[model samples]
Target: MNLQKFSLEQLASFVQGKAVGQTEMQLDGLASLTQADAHKLAFVNADKYLDQANQSKAGALIVTEELRAHITSQQNFIVVENPYLAFAILTHVFEKKHTAQGIEATAQIHASAIISDTAYIGHYAVIGEHCVVGDETVIQSHCHIDDGVEIGKQCFIDSHVVLTGHCKLGNRVRIHANTVIGGEGFGFAPYKGKWHRIAQLGSVLIGNDVRIGSNCSIDRGALDDTIIEDGVILDNLVQIAHNVKVGANTAMAAKCGVAGSTTIGKNCIFAGAVGVVGHINIADNVTVTGMSMVTKSISEAGSYSSGTPMLESLHWKRAAVRFKQLADAPLTQMLKRLDHMQAQIESLESTFKLRK
Candidate 1:
């Protein structure tokens, strides 16, 4: 898709920034400072990148007002409060142009399935019996839509995704490639020296504008529904267990695992590799730092963190030894101090009574 280059003035207006250089300079797209050409725009957000910005071949640059003095090139510059955020907006504008349109005939759609003519189904896709795909939805190659699955309008399902039976996805839901939805929960019972499988009869219900990253797995509930509420963004390799409810607008980073029956509240952020235990409730607007182990419920909305950072082997061993002795050391010292204080108080009282 070939699009017209935007003038510096137009870009500044689009990004709500102030023009610092020639407004008539044109920029076709955005690129990194080191690789940007004369037709592209680049941004400098870090002090370390200021040198690269000066030497960049781009015709235009987006930068904060504080970095203006460091610029050596006579190219067009747009000054914004946050250069990174401005670049994010511009990148999204150009990304929309490269998207494909309309469904392919090679898609294997069932006769009983209902798909909107406006929806785009890519090559080698399988839409199972009685499935309903809504308008303007795009299902890419090698995707499997099982029986009775319902996907709402304007959804984007990437390649190799599996939507198991009875899964329901709401409008504008974006699922990345190789993600599995509505898989059976890990539930089993031990009976007479044999393991008996507990059937996972419930489905997964995903709400509108939820973005699930690549290779993520969401398990279906054991007896109740596994619910992902509206506007949730899950990063790659995240594992969401059965009967878990992720509240609206919560964003979880990569490798985070939420165990079964945990209810995560709205607008919460979990950093990479955070592990939350089962059957706990996390309050709204909670922020969990990277690699934290959440073992209990959090009733207040605040930042919580656990787990020690990596240290040198020798130092770590010493610290571990000290940690083990901490419990006994504190109690022993408290008892000795209490005995001395009681003896001193009794002696002072006896002396005062004799003097009186």
Candidate 2:
């Protein structure tokens, strides 16, 4: 736990919220409404959690203006436009900065590399030739920064990270542990029924404020650069293939994969397990639901979902049979057949009337 203490007024000011109650009290930390102690601050973003907020033992609570009046609590409250956002802003105040000091003796830095005076290089970290590490950049232990890599100011390269082959990271980028950036793109050419390797010539360019989660793989380009624009956040185990251009502020959930040469527009949200094929383009502000597969270009911006909803065992078995029948003859073909059957029945009725 952080030993630092923040006054109620100070916390409210930091989040640009209004302190509606007592301001003399101090808070040591933050927690959820249900788990907060008397010295901790908490937040309630919705009406469903109001019960927890009323019962909370927190020193102070951040609440929205709409929910503030509904709460029947005597606890101190900080009213903000968005309580969740305010909570996010205050989280940084209590976060512990990395304690690793100056460049360690065990670090192996190339003579051609340029490291900032304010940078921290941890034990066994490797800095390759011609690499540039900017001010306040922290390359943690076992990190391998390969040749020609450039990392901008205040970038955090976590433990076991591999940044290689002309990769460039902009300022304030945070790559978590075990993430591999600028790896070789999977480019292959087939000739005479065998596979041949294609030399990857381009690099990866990551913009400022990008956060890549752990175990993520971002491949270098085969010819054109793979670009991840500013403010993009990638969840763990995401795969970004070569020559792909991800626009600014795009957020992808865990296990999302964008295949090579795809261009995704700005502010797109891809939920968990979303898979996008190569050579496609997605428009801005697109929201892909979880477990969705994007096989073609998304020309319009909107929400998309695929696959069947969860069902019980017996119901799923019956639906599965119908799904197979529909696959054999889709909706259009089935409708055409229905029209033909109706026409035949009307002709038979007319013939019977003529015979009478």
> lDDT for each of the candidates?
0.92, 0.93
lDDT of 1 by residue, 124-151 (tens): 9999999999998999999999999999
Q: Write the per-residue lDDT of candidate 2 for residues 302-332, one digit (tens) a residue.
A: 9999878899999999999987887675776
* Cα TM-score per model: 0.85, 0.93
Candidate number of the best lDDT: 2
Alpha carbon RMSD to native, model 2: 3.9
Model 2 scores a TM of: 0.93
